[model samples]
Target: MRITQGFTFEAAHFLPHVPETHRCRRMHGHSYRVELTLEGPVDPVTGFVVDFFDLEAAFAPLLQRLDHHCLNEVEGLENPTAELIAIWIWDRVKPAMPMLAVVKVYETAMSFAEYSGG
Candidate 1:
C-alpha cells in the first residue's frame, strides 16, 4: 500500500539559470505544496505502513527550513525549480524514510514535479 502526506509552505525564489528575459528569473513567491509518498506493507500491529504522526515528525526539521524561507538560499536548492525541489526533498527524506517512494512539489495549482529518487 501507499500513503501520501502533503505539506504547504510559503517561499520565495528565482531561477537564476533562466534567461534574463524570462519571468522566472525575477524573484517571486509561491504557496508551495509538497507531497511525500511512502510505499510499504502495512504493519500488522500498527495497521499502517508508517504512522502519519511519525512521518510528520521526521520531516519537521526539513519543513522548517523550507517554510517561509527563500528557496534559493537553502543549501542544495540554489536553483529551486519545482523539479529540483522534488529531487532535493527526495534526498533529504529518503534517509529518514526508507519507504519513501516519491517527492512531489507543486509550484502552482496546475504544475508540479515528482521525483522517485530517480
Candidate 2:
C-alpha cells in the first residue's frame, strides 16, 4: 500500500534563455503542488506507511526555500524547470525519509513531473 500527502506553495520563475515572446520567458508564478508518496510495509506502531506529520516536517525546509520566492534566485535552481524542481526536492528530503518512493511537483493543475530513486 501507499500513502501520499500534498502541499502547496507559490513561486515565480522565468526561462532566462527563452525568447522574450515566449510565454514562459517572462517572470510568472504558479500555485505549485508537491505530493510525496511513501511505499513499503506499513509501520505497525502507527499503522501507517509513514506519519503524515513526520513527512510534513521532512519537507518543511524545502517548503521554506520554494515558498513565495523567485525560483531562479533559489540556490541550485538557476533554471527551475518542473522536472529539475522535483529532483531538487527529492534530493533534499530523501535522506531524511529512506522509504520515500517518489516526489511529484505540479507546475499547474494539469502539468507535473516526478522523480524517484536513491
Candidate 3:
C-alpha cells in the first residue's frame, strides 16, 4: 500500500539563474505544500506501512529549516525552485524515512513538482 502525508511551510526565495527581466529573479514568498509519500506492504501487526506520527516527527526537523525563512539561504537550496525543493526534501528525509517513494511540492494552487528519489 502507499500512503501520503501533507505538510505546509512558508518561505521566500528567488531564482538567481533566471533572466534579470524575469519576475522570478525577485524574492517572493510562497505558502508551500509538501506531500511525502511512502510505499510498502502493510505491517501485519501495526496494519500500517508506517506510523503517521513517526513520519511527522521525522519530517519536523526539515520543516523547521524551511518554514518561515528564506529558502535560498538554506544549504542545498540556493535556487529553491519547486522542482529543486522537492528533490532537496527527498534527500533530507529519505535517510530517516527509507520507504519514501515521492516528494511532491506545491508552489501555488495550480503548480506543483514531484521528485521520486531519482
Candidate 4:
C-alpha cells in the first residue's frame, strides 16, 4: 500500500542559470505544494504503513525551513527548480522514513515534479 501526505509553503527563488532577460531570472515566489509518499504493507495491528501524525512530525522541520523563505538562499536549493526541490526534499526526509517512496513538488497548479530516490 502507498500513502501520501501533502504540505504547502511559500518561497521565492530565481534561476540564476536562465538568460538574464528571462522572467525567471527575476526573483519570483510560489505557493509551493509538496506531497510525500510512503510505500509498505499496511500493518495489520496499526492499520497503517505509518501514522499521518508521525509523517507530519518528521517533515515539520523541513516545512519550517522552506516556508516563507528565499529558496535561492537555502543551502541546498540555490536554483530551487521544482525538480531539484523534489529531490532535495526526498534527501532530507528519506532517512527518517525509510518507507518514503516519492517526493512531489508543484510550482504551480499545472506544473509539478516528482522524485523517487532514483
Q: TM-scores of all models?
A: 0.98, 0.94, 0.98, 0.98
User: Tens digits of per-residue lDDT for model 4 on 1-118?
Assistant: 9999999999999999989999999999999999999999999999999999999999999999999999988889998899999999999999999999999999998999999999
lDDT of 2 by residue, 1-118 (tens): 8889999999999988778899999899999999999888977898988889999999998899999999999998999999889989888888998888999999999999988863
Backbone clash total, candidate 3: 0
Runs of candidate 4 with Cα error greater than 4 angstroms are: none
Model 1: residues >4 Å from true position, as ranges? none
Lowest-scoring 10 consecutive residues by lDDT in candidate 3? 85-94
RMSD of 3: 0.6
Show the lowest summed lDDT stretch of 10 residues, model 2. Answer: 42-51
Q: For candidate 4, what is the lDDT?
A: 0.95
- Full-model lDDT for every candidate: 0.94, 0.91, 0.95, 0.95
User: On residues 1-118, what C-alpha lDDT tens digit does candidate 3 reach at each position?
Assistant: 9999999999999999999999999999999999999999999999999999999999999999999999999999999899999999898899999999999999998999999977
**Model 2: colliding residue pairs:** none
Model 4 TM-score, all chains together: 0.98
